[model samples]
Target: MDDGRENLDREQTIDRLEEFQKASVRAIEAHGFELKGERNGVAVFTDKETAKRSRDTFRFIAWDKVSEVADDLIRGATQHEEYTGVVNSSKRTAEYYVRVHRSLGMIQLRVLERQDWEANERTCGHDFTPNPPISSISALKPSGEKRTVGFHVNSRQEKTCIELSLASPTAEFLTNPWSFVSDHPLDGGPRDYSLKVIFDQSMDEAKVAESSLELASRTIFELDIRNGISLIFAPRERVRVSFDAPREVPRIRFPRVKVPREVAALFSFASETLDNPPYVFLSYYQVLEHFLPMAHRRDALKVLRRELRDPFFDENKDVTLIKLMNSIERTKQVSEEDQLKVLLRDFVRVDKITEFFKSADMKHFSNKGPISGVPEVVMHLKSDPLPTQAAKRIYALRNRIVHAKDDPKYDSIPVLLPRSTEANSLKPDVALARLLATEVLINSQD
Candidate 1:
């Protein structure tokens, strides 16, 4: 009967402990703290709203343990009047006091220690400048405390470092394990400090890291160029080429070579042909066709007729009649005169050809040199004998490549010169056509 009574008391004690645990959990929930998980046999709780905001875990002791401790103190309070007073004070403290600290994603920065009294005098506390100074605002409420985040820039030891101070019950520094280290400025100027990721609740950790690195790389590239520095990345080494002044880099002054708006659309197509195999030849011819001034066969015939009607031609009527008949027959065979030879013969002059060569050379080679192996191709075109011959030969080459099927002449001409030869040739005709086309496009812009 006594054993049965002892078992009954044990069962009652277990039931009361369970009741106390449940009540403690409820009280914690009412106090705006959530039971996160158990750690080291201790029930862990955190502020759910703070966790969401900072992306850092703010941990506290679970209320179940708090209640158990409270129960033990109250049970012992019946021993003495002083004990009773202590129990009441402890109850009040347990009910109100809560402490929180950063568990992960950030850490507390350690204060630098001084070796001697002189070192202490020289050292200052947190040598940092908060741009748009951080407000000393507290989020502490009657139930719980909330801390506001802060950012600052420090220029200590000639280096600019960005520091993030996280405010919890205990302050801590936020850090990432996947950060990269680069060369520091020798003079202690602003050093590159990269944040590989920003705390975002929506993205997973890996994605956040990847996005942050990509953004950092892009920003670095832009900064390097803007500051007249060339950053070259190689295996195991990073090369940075810094210029003394922005003027040293001419490319910045002129970002792009101006081209005519009318023919600007064609330049992309022409550029794309350099990559495409089948359309390569066609691209050159198309550009050339567009570059030339278009003329109708009927227009040529009308001009011929007007010349023949002149008084000087009337004296030579028989010669004029024969010439007119031949011209009429030729005009009947052709509807348009877009052919390079015909266009050059009718419209393009020697000076104009030289100008085209100079413009094309300036753009393509980035230097004023002879295009292809043609010596003074520009000057020769401007001078006496070779001008017309060179033009006709270039046109003839174009015709063989475009019109002829399986022709050897197409393989004979070297387009890229020393880079290409008779045995392994790039079509010279295509090269010349592209060059002239580029010139036309440039001229049309002005």
Candidate 2:
């Protein structure tokens, strides 16, 4: 057989299968359980839980691969040992036995049942002799396949219990939550022998909350032996784990925002709806964020330069436009011979202007006609209207607060820094900036 025959996709399938098989083996070995045998490619562990878990994982693999292993298991299963239990009775004794069937040989319980005269007759009595109808019992099929068949023996008067399980076949029978014993040993088996009542976190509310409270609980399991004589209780304790790990928040697709048909759509609106509804209005912020890219792109710059009507200023002059014009005229009126030197000096004084000039060759601009100054450059910028000359200072303070840094008057602008400090609440400025940005963006797209 080709070991490397599996392709990448098929290899993943096989690798997963191999991992599951190895895990099964490790678990069984860890719990001191023995390995039964290999049926086809599937390795069978002696623990019933291991076999059951493997069976569950196997169903997840491809049907074709599953069938191949299943067929192999059937062919090689002749000598397979299956764990089984039986209830037997004779003229002298009534008994129950847990046994293992193997391909090589069979191993039966040395002593599983005891004589109980009280069980034979309803009243309390001590009989030394084994009861009537003693018979040896064998499984009709493999115990691995049977989900729930109780090998039960009970008392007439009080509760007596005994049971074995393979449900979580790999799970340890002794440590299993359902397999509890009382500390104070009583006569006979546990009153209730239930295998299905396993400690599943999903089922128990107390266990789920226990982790937070650091609480632990124990269950008592008992088995009663002959005529109220032998009683045993095993205690299984479980500490509650606080709440389970939080589930991941599901991703939500934001609803599309459609612009009015009369108004041209310039940008997309995207918002996330969280599990808890936010009380504040976020539409204004969303609009601003959506509008910036559409308005300021280089390709759309030509269109914006035409439609950039001054929203804040009026008929004769926009505040920004007027400033630009005044600055331009002031430079032009200066004597041609001294204009370059004075302009260069002003450029050096302005931080932004100095950087703009230094970014390119100065000699080229000296030879060229119109040398742009800081104010001139500001005119060309296609950004939202300036919130404030002090906006940057307020933003810096906000940043300090957000990052857990202690700064006095964090929300309040200090009176000392007159130019940097302002009383304008960012809420309204932010809203207007968004609307203005949208206006610029839609017009630019035209």
Best by lDDT: 1
- Candidate 1 Cα outliers beyond 4 Å, as residue runs: 1-266, 276-281, 290-293, 296-306, 312-323, 332-338, 345-349, 355-378, 381-390, 399-431, 438-446
lDDT tens digits by residue: candidate 1, 67-126? 753343343311111101111122111000111122411221111010011233223344
List per-prediction Cα lDDT, in the order shown: 0.37, 0.28
Best by TM-score: 1
Judge candidate 2 at residue 168 and give its lDDT.
20
Backbone clash tally for model 2? 45
Q: Write the per-residue lDDT of candidate 2 for residues 1-446, one digit (tens) a residue.
A: 32211212423433556555545444434543433333233332233354435321111112223333333232221110111111111111111111222231111211223222124432324222222111221232334222222333323333222223222211122222221122111112222222222112232333322221111111111222222212121212111111123268656678343454322322222122211011011333333334333322432344344435545544466776765566455544543223222222222223443343445343423313121111112222346112221123222322322334346644342222111111111222222223333443344333
Per-residue error for 10 in candidate 1, Å, reads: 82
RMSD of 1: 28.3
Error of 1 at 357 (Å): 4.9
